[model samples]
Target: MTDNIDIDRSLGFTIAARNARGRLVRLGPVLESIISAHAYPPAIEKLLAEALVLTALLGATLKDDSGQMTLQAQTEGGPIDLLVCDYRGGELRGYIKFDAERLAEMPVNPTLFALFGKGYLAITFDQVATGERYQGIVPLEGATLADAAESYFAQSEQIPSLIRIGVTRDEHGCVAGGLMLQHLAEGEEGRDRIHTRLDHPEWEHVAILGSTIKIEELAQRDLPLETIVWRLFNEETEVRLLGGASLTKGCRCDVVHIRDVLSKFPAEERANMADDTGKIGVDCAFCSRIFAIPVAELENAGETTK
Candidate 1:
């Protein structure tokens, strides 16, 4: 648990012998930043933390570095209505929208169903380089977010996958971590392809090994990610580690950019947005920040641009 041991990063690895791949992510300050942006309750904080970790794990697998990965949970008849998180180029940001009164009525620790009564989880991948986007949606039916993610891979992608996420908060701050493993069976072209072999022996063995990871271990900041991977698959013949990626709190909110977009609106629309002080305020939910732009500025800018 050295102080300099890559606290906020994700490592990719493969067990060559088992035809499996995995990603391990640990968050320290990065999680703290995102959580601190809003004064979320303990339960909501923990849930958002898990979502961010899951986003990082899946985002790291993108073939293009410039691509983006977004995970959103939308529900009806639940305490939590919406939870959104996204990752792009090793940057992560997420927030949750929950009903305070409803959350207060739940038990000390509410179940997934209690928080999100009838929800669907959506995972979207956007490849900026090729302008291609793919998305998968699945009903949120599990005890934890990890279970829902595993369901997404199994149902939508038809891939054998395992995921574990953990979040712990104390007087110091918040820490979160996650691990995801997928069995990629060999194809006829000598490359990995999605195969419908949930009962395959190799996948079963690898999944069993992956399941041994406890939530406590995933949330342990002192334990190095590399050590965790080794402890799980040390018996494997070949475990190749890939390049690791660093993660940070990435809220893409720009005042200039936002203001410019506002300037494009019609003069009457801009006038209706102004407050008593003749300033229009734009709120960004992701970072919980407000941008104040003068109405005169937008009107003048709109006239010139139009």
Candidate 2:
């Protein structure tokens, strides 16, 4: 990497610099692990990567100790009817329900319109302690995933933000990365104070600088997230780092959960999910892990699969 960024690391981080400037950057190594774990195809991988990166950036902005955020999208006539992701405590899991027949005909690289056709993006946040929920829904008019995210803030949340994401795959694996800049109040990031700067010149200047970023540069896992920020806003003063979190491939699917879900189903329905060996088996869309429950477990209570 031309920039003095440490590319060897994979932790995702956000920068809340001075002057009401904020940027969130996620690297490939963290994202690629998810790609390998899920084994999604190229087009789906790209979509998932973009959604994951966007989720991390947006989720961090509103993260709380016991709050969970979810991002979901759906369309009328697209291959995927629904795509949803849940983020909480620096962890994420997402699933896509697609029309397999239609997906088979899609190109190796499909655009948002091609994959999802026309749809809406919905973001929801819920806090465990307060039982408080916040939701913002926006039309998916933007050609890119980041564009749709930006539109959500403009039309729903009323925040001035710019999100850009890019994904690339080589022989080794897929790498997805993105950066976002938001016009928070002039105070430093993570601070209690909030300032509204309607005429701030820095927002526009940063927007122009962010626009010049190339897809290749963002996809480089060897480039540090800080290096990307420095390359874009090195001249700016009072640059501050608002701390960061690491991301990994994780899914909540396990034998106990799977058996519980099967127990809720009637015996007849459960039988349909059973294999010839009289074991109930199902695949988790989030992580592609398979859980199998034996007949004894379905009949009464039994040990779980590892």
Q: What is the C-alpha lDDT of each candidate?
A: 0.89, 0.70
lDDT of 1 by residue, 1-306 (tens): 348365789999999778789999999989998889899988899899999999999999988989999999999889998999999999999999889999999988889999999999999999999999999999999999999999999888778899999899756589989999998766525533454374356888899999999988988878888889999999999899996888988999997798899888877888899999999999989889899999898777777875
Pairs in clash, predicted candidate 1: none
- Worst lDDT run of 10 residues, candidate 2, spans 1-10
Estimate TM-scores for all models. Answer: 0.95, 0.82
Task: Tell how far residue 243 is off in model 1, in angstroms.
Answer: 2.0
Cα lDDT of model 2 by residue, 1-306, tens digit: 233243212233333443444555554555666666754666777888788877776666654756888899989778988898877776777867787789889887767888888798999988877889989988888688789988887777556777888777765566667777777655445643223445455566767877888877777766667777778777776566665566555567778777777777777887887889998778777776777788667668523322
Give the Cα error of residue 250 in candidate 1, in Å.
1.1
- What TM-score does prediction 1 earn? 0.95
Where is model 1 more than 4 Å wrong at Cα?
A: 188-199, 303-306
- Quick one: how many clashes does candidate 1 have? 0
